[model samples]
Target: MCRLLGVVTHAPTRLADTLTDLIEPFTGLSREHCDGWGVAAWQPDGELAVSKDVLPAHASPAFAATLAGSVTDAALLHLRMASPGLPTEPRNTHPFSAGALAFAHNGYFAPVEAIDELIDPDLLAGADGDTDSERYFLRVLTRLHDEDPVDALALAAADIRERAQFASLNCLLLTQDALYAYSEENPDSEVSRRRGPDFFRLRYQARAGRVVVASSGIGAQDGDGWSLLPYRQVLEIRRSDLRVSTHLVRGALVGAGG
Candidate 1:
């Protein structure tokens, strides 16, 4: 199992306040998930900046301070727990990036041989490791390269549902102009799967004219208006404005001409 953290804002702000100070501490509850942490951000100049380590988040002073000073308009964070037999190399960390997109996941896709045909070869072509999540993200980018982010993501979900038997495919995406997220239906019937939340929620607030989106509710008293995204919902947040619409993602391959 793993954990994810993301922030999409109208302005470039440091990650310290939200991630290191707020989200990283939460990983302690999931014992196996403390393996390592990494974060990827979209550079205003069209490059990606990612910092990853094979060490636990709580013990890494460099990572902790890096989070405190990191600045970006959109970003994704991942806390990993390597599968017992798998090596804990830096390549296996989450928040894998390609071009203007950054991807991270929270579950495993075992017996990967079964879905070997569905995954794109190019995805593995650039992978630093053999983790299934990286393969899945690469496959998704293949379909998304020239399409709308919202549509590509929905289509990718349908493709993923076929072999994963309920992949906890909670992904955070950072595009050139917006931030998107998808929390797929968790297939808990599988023994090696991790649990996911019933709700996939996020919020975007106007701060000094910049928009900020987050997966967690803001404010200690819960006074904020956090938008609740349904299981198959897609959200686009940019410049403080949010556009949300529901799309049936799970059965994308089955109900095609309907």
Candidate 2:
């Protein structure tokens, strides 16, 4: 598994201090997930700028330099430990983006062929690598960026559940307007999610007018409310309020603000 993090805010903040500098040392939840790390930031006009590599975060000067100067209102990060033959190259890294949305995952899929079938054919150009994480993001982007966002996400999730069995499906999606975190896994038999030790124990930190999402709890402080999000639910977070809606949000209600 890999470590993940994201920052969605109402103001432009320096990621080097919170998400990057904090996770660089060997002292937090993101400490050991240094195999590969990347950041996706939203430009002032809602454009997405992403950078990723297979190198360890603690060692890569490029990533270090990039993070040092990185600042954005919304961003995503992934520190990967490459799965088997997935190849540890820059292209295989995460935070895959389309026009205004950036996506990343922390798990692997079953079959590549089946995963390929779930994605929209025309949006395949966004894919820069063969990793399932990128493919999954591309597929979801195709649906989400379509004329209908809610329908696309539902269709993408259903497509994933039908094909990628016995796998962990933890996804973080950031669009132009808001950010969504869906915590669930579709196993071969039954789908579920666990926290604390094995599965997604990630924390949602809201402080100093900034809200960030990470793969695990870093325990920086107590009063921050750093909540552990629930599984099978979709969290729609904006600048001020964060709301979580129930599962399979109908296409008619997908675009609705949480």
Candidate 3:
């Protein structure tokens, strides 16, 4: 399990400035989810930057330095809690990057070989980590060859749902153009039961200047302009204007409000 936090601002702004009140609460989650931490940020110019470490966010000076006033139009933060048999190393950290896209996942799937069958051989050959999350990201990237970002994620997620048993497929995908969030999970999974029902639930808030999406642990309260993203759905937040859209995995635009 892990904690995910993504932010998109109408104009480039430091994360500290964009998420003034929520930063502490979000990073504070590292006390428990202390395996490692990673961040991916992008500027309006379409340049993406990523930083991560094997240290817990609360204890890592690198995390503080990266988040302290760095300007960006969009950013995604991940606090990882490694699964039972996974290693806690830099390669296994969240926010894995390939080219211009960065991905962070908050779930785990069983019998890695089962899911490995879905990835492209060449793509799988380039993997530097032994995590199911990175493979999930690569699966989405493989689908990106023909489909759009949202669709690629949807297809990859749908495939995982059908072929492998997983606790949660909830993830944050950050691109040069937009920020994508997908929420899907098996409530009956052991991890879910151990954590609580809301463990896999994702929530987002669209403020006047920015849109913030995060896991349930963030300090967001109900009716505070925060809305829980529906399961089996993906939400897109345009970087240019912060326009938001919600879509079903099967290709229906449920809502475009935000």
Candidate 4:
């Protein structure tokens, strides 16, 4: 399991001011999910900037410096607690990037080999590490060139569902103009049962021209305005206007849109 935090706003904002309160406390969660941390921010000229460390967020001076130095209208942050067998290496870190897109996931699934077979060869060839999350992101990126982000995600979910079962597929996908997120879980899966119900909880708050969607820990503390995003649902927040939209991912697949 892991923690995810994302923000999209109408005005350029410093991460220190926009997310420090929420993220500072969230880092303490690394005490349990202490594998690694990664952050991705969209630059003013529409490029993606990423920083990652294999060290746990709470203890990493690099993590603290990156957060305080970053200023952007759109950003994605992840704290990873690696599943069994995966290493705590920079390549395995979250907020994986390809082109202008960045992705972070907060769950586990099986049959990684099967998932790899479904990814585009070109993308798979460039893979830096062997985490299922990175393979999943590559699969999504392949479809993104031909389909809208939402549709691409839905397709990726559908494909994964066909290949294997997943405990949860909660993820955040960041593009230059928007933030896309989703929450999905198979309640009967062994991983899900072990992690407990709240393990996959996701929520969002849209207020004061800023919108944020995150895993339970961060959103839960945002107070009165937060709303739980239903399981199997995808959320989109446009950075241009801070508009929000929601969609149900068809079938048992877990997908995202923006």
Candidate 5:
């Protein structure tokens, strides 16, 4: 399991400024989910800038520095609580990057091979770490060849749900163009039962000029500005205008945010 935080704003903004008082509480989640941490931010030139470490976010000097220094219209933050067998290392860290896209996952699937068999051999060959999450990212990337980010994720996620035993499929995808969030969890999975129903839930808050989507434990309460993202759905926030659109897996846009 992991914690994900993504921000998309109409204008470039520092992460601290965007997260405000919730920043520390969010990073404090590292106390329990302390395997590693990573941040992917967009540069003014539109290039994706990524920095990560094997250290816990609460303990890593670099983590604090990156949060304080990153100034972009979009970013993704992850605090990892590695699966039982995965290692704590840079290669296995969250926010894996490929070209201009960055991805972070908060769930795991069994036998990793289930998803591996579905990915292009050439693309699977490029995997740097032995993590279901990384493979999940590659799976989505593989689908990107034929679908837009939203559709690609829906396809990738559906394939996993059908072929693998998973606890959750929630994730955050950051691109120069928009921020994408997908939420889905096996209601009867061990992790879900252990972490409670809200464990894999995702929520977002969209106000003038900015939109933020995050995993459940960010001190967000119901009836607050945050709205729950429904299951098996993808939420897209275009960076150009912070326009929000929601889509069901393999379905049409069902609603809009803010």
Candidate 6:
């Protein structure tokens, strides 16, 4: 499991102001999701810059330094809690990137071999780590070449669900111009019982010409402008006008609640 935070603003913004406060207590979450930390931001010239460390967010100076800097219009942050049997290394960190896309996932799926078979040989060759999250990201990236992001992710989610009976697939996908988010989990699974329901729940807030989406409302109070993104839903937030488009990729499953 992991914690994910993504932001899309109407203009260039210092992440320090927008994310500093939100990320302060987030580091505290490292008490559980303490494996590693990573951040990816779009640069002014439309390139993605990623910095990651295999140290807990609460203890890593690199994590603090990365957040103190500025990001052009979008940023993605992740705090990883390694799943059983997976090693904690920089290569296994989140916000995995390829070309202009960066991705982070907060859930786990099993039978790694099954997921690997679904990915193209070329894309699988790009994976630097063995975590299922990286494989999921690559699967989605492969779909990006032929479909829109939302639809591409939907396909990825469907494929995972079919191969793995009990899995959670909540993720945040970032491109230069927009942020795409998805939330889904199998409530009956052991993974869900161990991680707690709120761990997989994702929330978002759209205000002040900005849209912020996260795996949980760690930095935000219950009220404010935040609203829970229902399970099985996907969101597309554009930076140009801060327009948000949402679509339901799967039917709401019974017993699934945030």
When 5 and 6 are scored with TM-score, the better candidate is: 5
**Candidate 6 lDDT tens digits, 1-258:** 788988988887778777655776777888789999999898777778999998898888888878777566898889998989999988999989988889999888887665777777899987799888988898888777777888777778877887776457889999867899988888988878876777688888888867889877385535678778777778889978989888875433322111
Candidate 3 weakest lDDT stretch, 10 residues: 249-258
TM-score, structure 2 vs. true? 0.79
RMSD in order of candidates: 4.1, 4.8, 3.9, 2.7, 3.8, 3.6
Per-residue alpha-carbon lDDT of candidate 3 for residues 100-175, written as tens digits (9 for 90 to 100): 9999999998766656777788999999899989999988888888789988887788777766789999999998
Ranking by TM-score: 5, 3, 4, 6, 2, 1
Candidates' C-alpha lDDT: 0.62, 0.63, 0.87, 0.83, 0.88, 0.82
TM-score of each: 0.78, 0.79, 0.94, 0.93, 0.95, 0.92
Pick by TM-score: which candidate is best?
5
TM-score (C-alpha, index-matched) for candidate 6: 0.92
Please provide, for model 2 over 25-133, each residue's C-alpha lDDT reduced to its tens digit, 9 standing for 90 to 100: 4223334565577788876665678887667777677676766677677777777866678777778777777677778787777675566755577767556787877
Ranking by lDDT: 5, 3, 4, 6, 2, 1
> Of 2 and 4, which scores higher on lDDT?
4
Model 2 scores a C-alpha lDDT of 0.63
List, residue by residue over 1-258, the lDDT tens digit for candidate 1. Answer: 576666665566777764444554444522556778888876566577888887887777767776777777677777787765777888878878877677887666665443456556766556677777776677678767655777666666666666555445567677776777765555454432333333223433434433334444223122353445555555666524434344555445342210
| Candidate 2 collision pairs | 202-215
User: For candidate 4, what is the lDDT?
Assistant: 0.83
The alpha-carbon deviation from the true structure for residue 41 of candidate 4, after best TM-score superposition, in angstroms, is: 0.2
